[model samples]
Target: MASGASDCHFHGNAVATQATVSTCAAKYQKDLIASGKIAKSWAAVKEPASFEQIDGEKGKEWKVTFKDPAAADKSKESLYMFFTAQGNFIAANHTGK
Candidate 1:
């Protein structure tokens, strides 16, 4: 679904922690597959995701960007997943026209 920029409150200067980010990304990808948005056979997201802290948000919160290989063009199918810093799924969306 199309989303407006106002939907999030992400900020610059994300926390630098590879372990935490990997864990969250794993869970987010799993949840996405479980939700049927991504096929299980695809097995993984097309690229690594970067994490960002949401200003004033409670709990560990991050915004991850990745692509579903089954989707259309990379530009049109770029996907975003939001997760709690502890790796809980929150929301997702597609970018591009």
Candidate 2:
């Protein structure tokens, strides 16, 4: 489980992989989750299915305007996902476990 300001990795469809998450950016990483690019969703068959909000234009779009470790920049390479909240996988993006 990745934490603030650090770096973490979340497996998504073939579109994204860090080879390790540390090198990734926070914005891109959260995008994967919020955009429903997770690996679990890639599978055609499964015991259960899941999805991400992507914060539709009608609703609220996810933003990273403010955060701890203030050092986190939106321009980072986030190509993975992490848990932004507990038990809530959709919004969760890679944080650096």
Candidate 3:
């Protein structure tokens, strides 16, 4: 799949490309901050620290990680957001595990 393309559909799912997943991850981060679910300091990190595709028991999953240097606790500095191959948000937490 081309990096410029938004996504590719297979079966009924819209499989997201790297660019598409990054956009989705950004939106999810913004929404979390807006909803007060996460610290506003997270906004300081404009870009994700990493993006990864994992093949697990449930199938393909996308992980977007952001490092918030302003976080009070070092353990909570890294925020990990998860999504489905289709770009659907799954969950988020400090521990990627």
* Candidate topping TM-score: 3
TM-score, model 1 to reference: 0.50
User: TM-score of every model?
Assistant: 0.50, 0.17, 0.82
Question: For residues 34-97, could you state the per-residue lDDT of candidate 3 as single tens digits?
Answer: 9998888888888999999998458999988999877899999999998878777788999996
Off by over 4 Å in 3: 1-11
**lDDT (Cα, tens digit) per residue for candidate 1, span 1-97:** 5432233222334543545555556666776778898657436564554656663256555677765666555553556666655444567766411
Candidate 3, residue 18: the lDDT equals 76
Q: How far is candidate 2 from the true structure (C-alpha RMSD, Å)?
A: 16.1
List ranges where model 2 is wrong by over 4 Å: 1-24, 39-97
User: Model 3 scores what on Cα lDDT?
Assistant: 0.81
Off by over 4 Å in 1: 1-16, 39-47, 56-60, 68-70, 73-76, 95-97
Weakest lDDT window of 10 consecutive positions for candidate 2: 42-51
Of models 2 and 3, which has the larger lDDT? 3
Q: Whole-model Cα lDDT per candidate?
A: 0.56, 0.31, 0.81
Model 2, TM vs. native: 0.17
Candidate that scores best on lDDT:
3
In candidate 1, how many Å is residue 40 off?
A: 5.3
Pick by lDDT: 1 or 2, better one: 1
